[model samples]
Target: MNDTYKMMIVDDEFEIREGLNSFYWERFQFQVVGLAANGKQALDLMQRSDVDIVLTDIKMPIMDGIELSRAISVHYPHVKIVILSGYKEFSYARDALQAGVSEYLLKPVDLKHLGESMMKLKHLLDTERQSSQKLQSYENQLANSLPAARDHFFQSLLEDLLPEYHEAKEKMSLLEIEMNATYYCCAAVKIQWRDQPDGSLTDANKLAKATTIIERHLEASQCHSYTLKRKAGELAIFLNLNATTVSPRKSLSLLFDHIIVAIEGELGGRSIIGLGEVYQSLLSFPDSYKQARSIMERHIFRERSGLFQWDPADSLHMERKEYPYSVETKLLDAVLEGNSGNSTMYFQHFWDSCGLDSEHAELPLVLRYLTPLFTMLERRLDLHGASFETMANLHMPFTEYVEQFQTLSQLKIALDRLISDITLHIRKLNDVVQTTSHSAVQQVKKYIEEHSSEKITLNQMADLVYLNPSYFSIQFKKETGINFIDYLKYCRMEKAKELLRRIDLKVYEIGELVGYQDRKYFATTFKSYTKLTPLEYRQSFITY
Candidate 1:
């Protein structure tokens, strides 16, 4: 609460003004900062002073309390008004109340009543100030989180997660992304260090610096651009071009030329940019991104650092060949069924189906064919609550997996090993499901109860119970008549309710104890679960 509130005294009579000013306003945690004879003078004084409350007489010369109150209500709605008047007319009090007067006291004001009114106004001011502070804190937090949120939105957009135009438009507006262009283009930029290692601070600093340089150049260009860090040493730049532009392709090419030159000449590092064609609708952004990524992947064969634009004619050879989807499906089924031998056989069959020989498939045609296959396998693992990290000890960005092998035979061997590892992991999971099917669900429930305050994931729980995520989900639901996600939410909400009983714990601190890192999200979830916000719930428990 604020220690002192500044107040103004407005009255035509000098005696009334002086007497009120002489009183011990400090006792009520207020200070009389100004004295005005009328409403006009009061308004003038208010402009010069920071007044929190205004005590004015109803009938005064030039301007009156009602007019002053209305003016304050219009210009300074936060300022509390107390009316002191000799007139006892019901109309005077009615007009005063309508004009936003906080309290109306007659001619001979009671000292006790005045003191009480001051206390009440002070409490209201304090509460409003606290609410304002909380709102400002939330705004600051939202501001800090906007960058990460924007990155996530762009990633989802590139992945074609927001399928509907309206949904994508809503998200873009929420993220403050202003992509108001008739044409859209995507470019994938990969930064390779000439000397430094991948994960060093120098790598990050250089990448950030390179991004800054690129942004500066883009800002100077005619088109609108947005840059997102796709992965380590990789950036995705989305361009919004005007329909009136003569040659969007040539414009983007020239921009990339400057960007590449700046990185290579200034940072002594190599940069490869893959430019995609412009599209009319934002829904086609994923197609543009795919094209750009496809061009970027070709860098593995060329081993060059420069700008590469997508050419429709260049892909004709690969487009004519039939993709071995049947072999891929067989391999995926074998892995999921935990048959390592069949998985290996199917994987080899898939490789041979690609029409590859013992010599390295260094051609871009073979890469274009194999890349989508590996991407599909990765996606399949993800769907089954598995990852390349756990199964094959491989980190993401899939390109790293391909770069590990120099020849087609080596890639085949590595992929076979991955298939073997995945099948073995799945076999173990199936064995556990057979042995402790019922107790595994109980074990997961107990784990959730004990570890609700920690980060828990369905995949982690599935791994713990040694069952496939899909199977674990079905079994857990059958045992408890509730899904794993709901059960986890129930445990967390129950814990939050219990913590809200403690007067010492702040709402955010309670949220943290209940495993919600974001305070706003916690409050929202809490209100949705319990029909009360964290603060409201706590207040309900208090004994007045």
Candidate 2:
């Protein structure tokens, strides 16, 4: 990994961008130099700074992460971007991916996961940088020109028309493409605009113009080829070569960067690029090019506009899996009815079916699939008048949250917290009715103040109000803007606070008087509500 890499953070929220800077990014091989309020400012800052990595929020003003990422991918191809997003941008993951974002992190950023992603990017940057440096050291004799013969030779090689290795060398010498390097890599670019402006130039003519512009960006000599395919295609290229010090892929990727911008800037519009890996011989050319094209095809299906590189290690394509509607409805039913136990059980079954329980579940795939469930929950919670803090808790896990869980069991534990919370809210609502009499609500409130030290229940309050527990629950919330249990707890804690004003009563006595047997638990609850322990609360003021 690069040890002295510089990083910039872009977000609409000041605290988030500042929090990223506050973390020890330097420990993860990054130096935070500039902070921008939005993507537009980030881009301007990028031009003036020597930054290597960017951590940007997806939905910034003026320019969003998608648009910013697309610009960076085309203009500063070497710079890696990591997206910081909330649930609203979950659907944009594929779009962000197309824009060449290195990673996507959910909001309430977890520094540990952020560190892991940054370090991984560091290794990538270091490798590419080292390779680029090595390529420059090879020192070409003079810029050489790639002619039509070289293009024909490459086409023959890709088509397996070339005969033997010895004959291949003869062809390389004949075409002036034999370099001193021993290794080879191939890169291919395809341009299919999402929206192309109507123009007089034919697709062939457009490809030809792009090809000519591309030629000006490539090295003239020793070992590069260029071809404009006017028939049966957009761009079908095969690179078969030896692995050596030449670093052909880096050069190709660089040329690709230039051509991408030129085409998008000059031609119709946005396009997708697929880069293939290096192989040692002609036998592997077919496989490498096919892999590159396959990756590009997937990107096209995703409707993203960015460079898609082939990873030789993983050739398996992701399968799209849908959650069963039957199981989904069962969980939703449990949630609405406030059945925490049943909801958890149904969700567990559904999660297992998603194959996310496997020991090796991919985070992005699991997150992408689970995003919808989270959005649905948040929207429902909003309709119920939950506090903002509670909603934030709901967002934590589904967003690219803490990466601490190595197993599905651990992840489930975190999810269970969210499930229980929603169920709890619904249960609170289940016990009251909004249309109940105001005097009845006041009677319940007075009873809560009088008997808060005793164990209280919604049934007891409903008995006093002469209504069903469910109706009382809704009416209580409507009249007082809080559920019965919460109102009771508030009364108990307030009474405990008032008792602390008297110096003679011990903390344990105060706890028992407040209907808590465990003094420790009492202190914990007190601290949560008042931000002070019983002793601390008592010590803060002199008892007169």
Candidate 3:
């Protein structure tokens, strides 16, 4: 696993070899593994030892630098050879280059140049070593490729919303398909690390070790249909929830409790899990994924490591409503000011404006509302396609505030401080933009959002924003993190959420209101947004 280089130096003069060994060892950060007085001796040592680099002087008794270089090029193609010539002869340099010498240095070489050459050789050695190690590791992993591939294939099949049973059986003969068994329930085991007493899981290696330990336990279990999948820093065990053989809840409980206790007892990191709803057939796997993601997202509320069952009853309890744009702006401004009062006022107003008391709470609503604005700012910066870091260091951290902020009163104070700081930085960036693009995007976004539900064309939008259509389209997409069409679709979809919540209208009517004339197209669009069909969404709210 260790792949740092071991270099060998050969020369007729002992002082020369010693100087190179010591100088390269200390100054250039290379290990002088071997030294020889002649090329034959050096070749002998190199053949026996795991050498990555070779340095040899020209004009030796048995083998000169050119001959040695040729031998190394032929025998150890991975080894990098450096030629040291006392005479500044073109013939010697040409022969050295022909023999595949990696570098050439004249006698009485500057220590600086020697150190630089050694550094280059060291890089080559390290790169070769890493490549060799990775190739070997890949080969070793390939030994278990059949079973790993089988597991992956099964997992894919289980995860597919529309798995063709016959095709699956043909591809995987070992599955032994039971066609009559249509009711498929899913059990998910979420493995999480316990929180540290220091309040941060900064040690990534330690967290990975904990996850590995939990995954090993599941692998040893007799759950035939179980497959482990890791995503977004969480481990998920997908199980076929068959009521006949085992109860999904009981199975989930045993795994969660066992794993949670184990993680707490062994690793010092927080752990929590939420079981998904029992869905029928492979076609409903998307539902299972949503369930898992939804559950995991709420792990912050579950207090780290805890077992949770899928209960639609908690559906109403989830979802944090979006903070209004003006309030968010004010909150961003408050954070910039480092003031608690204004931030609190904005934060409270945002939540109250959202009216989460009557609807499902969501982070997406807030993140979607805020991320776009930030992205717009980032777009406005135009730091020659510089990264977010290169752009103004203005960040509101609304998600953090929403998640960790305790009391409504405390959140308001924190919100104001957050808003103030953000607004200050935003103002500075706005000034920067005025000198450049005049924040053409700001006016463009306002127009787009205002007319998202209207039949507005790109040309019209471009003209309104006072930019060429082509350039505006490019800049708009770059600024908003989405194309104009996509942005419009997103805005309309968001508007549709409000319309859907109001039980007064039909799906088609809402579609037209959102600028979609076709009801079928609207249903598809709504599904794309909420993962629920328009009818299904309406049914979710039906009290009768």
Better of 1 and 2 by TM-score: 1
Candidate 2: minimum summed lDDT over ten consecutive residues — where? Answer: 137-146
Q: What does candidate 1's lDDT look like per residue over 125-153, in tens digits?
A: 88888887885576567657878998888
Better of 2 and 3 by TM-score: 3
Every candidate's lDDT: 0.78, 0.66, 0.60
TM-score-based ranking: 1, 3, 2
Candidate 1: stretches off by over 4 Å: 13-15, 45-49, 160-162, 192-201, 217-224, 257-269, 297-306, 317-544
For candidate 2, write residues 1-544 as lDDT tens digits.
4458888888888877777788887676778889998878887887777778888888877998889898788657678899888854456898988889889888776778777887788888889888866643431211123355666776775664533332344345334342324434444566665345565777767777766765555534223444536233356654433444557676566656766787777875456768776654443454556666777777765454577777755654533443333465567556655778998898887787677777677777677556656655554445445532564353444565536667666877877787777787776765554345688888888876776555566667778777655445556766777656566668888999888876545788677667665565577668868998898898887431
Predict model 3's lDDT versus the native: 0.60
* Alpha-carbon RMSD, each predicted model: 15.1, 32.3, 23.3
- Compared with the true structure, the alpha-carbon lDDT of candidate 1 equals 0.78
Q: List the pairs of residues colliding in candidate 1.
A: none
- Candidate 2 local distance difference test against the native: 0.66
- lDDT, candidate 3, 246-283, per-residue tens: 56567657866787777777766566666666554444
